[model samples]
Each structure stands twice: as C-alpha cells, then as structure tokens.
Target: MYRCDCKSNVLSVLLYVSECWKFTANIEKRLEVFQTKCLRRIMRIFWPNMISNEELRRRAGVSTISEIIATRRWQWLGHVCRMPIDSIPRVALRWTPQGKRNRGRPKETWRRTVDRDLKTRGLTLQTAPTIAADRAKWRSLAVASSTRRRRED
Candidate 1:
C-alpha cells in the first residue's frame, strides 16, 4: 500500500524488512539470511491483536507454493480466463513449452523453427524446388563473374 521510494531511508528499510517477513513460494532455495524478524514490531501496528510469530511463520510458508493457492490476489484470474474481455491482448507474454525447451530464450514462432531445421538439415527443404533453383542461380552468377574477369585479362 505504501511506496518505499517516497519515504526516508529508515522508513524504506522498515518497509522492505516488513515485506521480507512474508515468505514467497517462487523462491527455490531456503534463503535463511533474507528471512529476518525486523517486521515483527511493525505488524503489530496494523493488527493490534497481534498474530503469534508461529502462526505468522506458518502463514508465510503456505504462500510459497508451486501452484496458486486460495488467495485473494488470484480470485479474479479464473474469471479473466473464462471471459476474455477483448480480442486484442493488452500485453504480450513469452510462451515456452515445458521440458522440450528449458532455460535460455524460447523459439518465438513455430514456422521459424521448422524453417531453420529444414534449411540446416536439408530435410523438408530438399523437396522445395524453388529453394533449390535459387541456390543454383546464385552459383551460376558467381561462375559467370569469374569467366568474364578471365577474358578481360
């Protein structure tokens, strides 16, 4: 709810430290160092009843899941899928197939991938006579240039 940049250094650190108190599910490793208790005092300001540290730690642990849990943030995600409001996508996101390609950049287009493999491996492209003719034409032009140069000498 609060922007850290707008605040002083002390307030910024407190805000940053407060967020760290909540565990993230996306994190792969147990970053024990990043998990600190500086936010323990600050949380009491909002929840005066004071949720116990054990309960708090348990809640944080649950948030870091491989799949989305029954959280408030994702409540509208299901609706967003069912009723795609507009044909035009507001944002473009990179799509990557799992297992087939892991890490690094993923191929943007299926046509691009098929074309690349065909050209390099001489598979599908060998049957395409147009491509074959283009290569033959280029080779003939190169040979004709050399022959003309020899005649001038």
Candidate 2:
C-alpha cells in the first residue's frame, strides 16, 4: 500500500519531465541517494540497522532509480523517433551544431546518453528511428531494457 503510493505519487512527481534530463554522474548519484532515503523511511529502516541498497530495493519490489530513468528516456526517444521529420523535436534530435566548442572534455548530453543506450542494444541513431517505427519492436525493447539491471561503471 505504502510502497504503491510512494511509487505512484512521489516517484511520479520526482521524475516528472525527466525524459529530457541530461543525466550526469552527479545527478545520478543524487537521485539514487534521495530515492534510497525515501525508501528507507517508508520501510521504517532507521540508523544502526543497515541494509544494502540492493536488498532494500528487492524488499521494496522496486527497480533502481537509474533503471527507471533510463527506461523513461528510451520510451521518450522512441516517441521522438516516430515523430514526423518536420516536427520540432524530431528536427532537434537530428540537428548538428556548426561551431566548435571550447577546448576540454565534451559535456554529456541527453542525445549522447540516448545514443549510448542505443549502442548497448546494438542499435545506432540511424537505425533507431527505423526500429522505433515498428511499435511492437520498440515496446519490447523498452520492456527488455527496463528489466535489465544497470551496470555501475
């Protein structure tokens, strides 16, 4: 009961519009910490009685926040991929800048993250739209991706 409410209400609000978020390591860490804290509180597990995050999540029947975020991102990507070429989001997704950036490591972007996810599934940005055009295939991929545990780097 409590778990369902926390997931449906709190998690939904917490992740609202997250499909467009540029997920960096720091952001991922913060979200994971916040979710762990919330889950611990809801489960009434206080200090001195420690539990591994994996164990806690297993008990709570929840996927990691990263998994949830990744699932949402891919789902959104599929939608964007299926959009008409003239649509703003579709155009934006395929847009490339004409200028060079300041000299350092390139910043991680939402598009880059999506590309990475696609690569993990042996797909590329070029191929993704083709696959996403088929709703059944994209839906299966989305479900499969969500069920697979994320590996920590």
Number of the top-ranking candidate, with TM-score as the measure? 2
Residue 72, model 2, lDDT: 90
Instruction: Give the per-residue lDDT of model 2 (tens digit) for 1-153.
Output: 667967997799999999899898899999999999999899899989989998888888888888888889988999999999899999999888888877895689888888888987889989999999998999888777666655432
Q: How accurate is candidate 1 locally (lDDT)?
A: 0.33
- Per-candidate clash tally: 1, 0
Please list the C-alpha lDDT of all candidates, in the order they appear. 0.33, 0.87
Runs with alpha carbons beyond 4 Å of true place in candidate 2 = 103-106, 150-153
TM-score between model 1 and native: 0.24
Residue range with the least summed lDDT across 10 consecutive positions in model 1: 65-74
* Top candidate (lDDT): 2
